[model samples]
Target: MAQPTAAESWSGGNEPMKAEYGKLMMWFFLVSDALTFTGFLTAYGFMRFGHEATWPIAEDVFTHFPGIEGDQPLLYVAFMTFVLIMSSVTMVIAVNAGHQLKKTAVAWWMIATIVGGFIFVGSQAWEWYHFIIGDKGGIELADGRVLKVAEAQTGEVLSLSQLVDGEAGHASNHLEKFSTGEVKTAFEANEGLVLQSPGKGHAQLTRTESLRLMQNAQVVQGANMKHNEYGQGQFANFFFFITGFHGFHVFSGVIFNIIIFYNVLLGTYERRKSYLMVEKVGLYWHFVDLVWVFVFTFFYLV
Candidate 1:
């Protein structure tokens, strides 16, 4: 056995290992991860493709804003989209700081990333709550026409003409007195909606109860014909599953960022003299951001 010369031991001196070790490993990991994500995305596409007709139009389904009325289209989700993109920008900055060996800067930028993650998660929770507890209840009729239950105490869900004509039925005279502002905000149309239980231990309505409501023809699904209360079944299913999956990712990202923050404070990277740990974490954070970009496009944009 003989000791190799310095030059022979050097990577460039012998048969090249192809790419630099760190970069090669990163690329390999990225390729595998890309495939994993592709599996999820492809699955989503297959499900959506088969049920296109039964999927709600994204804009019509999610356009709930204060002071908006009658199914007017809105772009609030575009704002959220921008916020998530900007968070990606901040994460990139943190990655660059690690390259420059700026530990304090890395700590601060990592904290910002966590804050952005928190904001995004909070927004998602708000969206979920709004969707689950929408003001109107949806009833699927035997003939398949949906009946919408409004906040009106009067049992009658009357048309504007019927209300003025005094022909609205028993629950019709309750006079909820919702102004345009209130109605627009309180009664978001087409979102996945569930009826609130009357009180504790009250049995929640099943499909049977919902069908019964529709059988009586008590209420038109929407007075203004703005939107049917029953969102396309496929849309509601995808909406919950996709957003819930992304939220889980965001939660995990926050936890990961916290660990990195502690590492930064303790000067671990400085002792190691390489910020590869930060780079690795950055890759993970960017992957999260990338997943959200697709989610926004599929769930909110299209």
Candidate 2:
């Protein structure tokens, strides 16, 4: 019996795909993941708009970089976004190299993508630390309203320790929790720190108003499942859950890329004379990057 000709094989099978099982499976996974993210984001949108009065501002919540500081809002997150997008570009280059069987170029491009993933993942970790530990510590009132001290002259937000005389540690360290009486005393003694009130503007508190508002205040550190320096607890919950979920995906992609990079180093694809695996992985890498664009817009830019 004679085998089918090359032309016949190329033109047949479900129209084109001869054995693109991996690509098909990857698409299925991406579609399912998209649905999950859509549901979560929808819930977030509803909760956010429902309680618009108490929702935290994205810019203020995620404003930290590393050594360099001073209220450089959204700078670090923007860099993370850029790194992730560049990684997707490198993935495209890697897939192209794989198609051409340029083993060296493929390996190098994969390495670049891996490095970008690391930077993104690490940036996410730092963000989590800052968020969980909080920056400007606030005082929670009886009605669940959180109020932070701001400079009356410069409008600079001050942590509770600054206004309240507590044996506080560094912003990154465990805070020395202050009582309501202490906070009230501090505010009464120092006429510098003002109050941050919503709706009336971020800095719309008189010296006397600030002193009166601290009548029933309790110290609150950064943010957690229960409390947040920003606003409502839901804000912190959603931030942690949504961003943490995306971070896990990026981490998984890093591991997958590492496995493929290891295979590239060992000449596995070269021996097989096919770069199909690299192309499949590239599809996943691009999908991850695409999802992040939406997340960034929804959470940060919006």
Candidate 1 structure quality by residue, lDDT tens digits, 6-120: 8768744453554446656766776786676677667767876775544445664455543544333435566556667777778889889988999989989888888888888
Model 1 weakest 10-residue run by lDDT:
194-203
**Compared with the true structure, what per-residue lDDT tens digits does model 2 show for residues 64-107?**
67776456788988999999999999999999999999999999
Give the runs in model 1 whose Cα sits over 4 Å from its true position: 1-37, 65-74, 135-137, 143-229
Each model's TM-score, in the order given? 0.63, 0.85
Q: Which candidate number maximizes TM-score?
A: 2
Lowest lDDT block of 10, candidate 2: 165-174
In model 2, which runs have C-alpha deviations exceeding 4 angstroms? 1-13, 16-19, 151-156, 165-179, 190-194, 198-213
lDDT, each prediction: 0.58, 0.81
Tell me model 2's lDDT, rounded to 2 decimals. 0.81
In candidate 2, how many clashes are counted? Answer: 1
lDDT, residue 247, model 2: 91
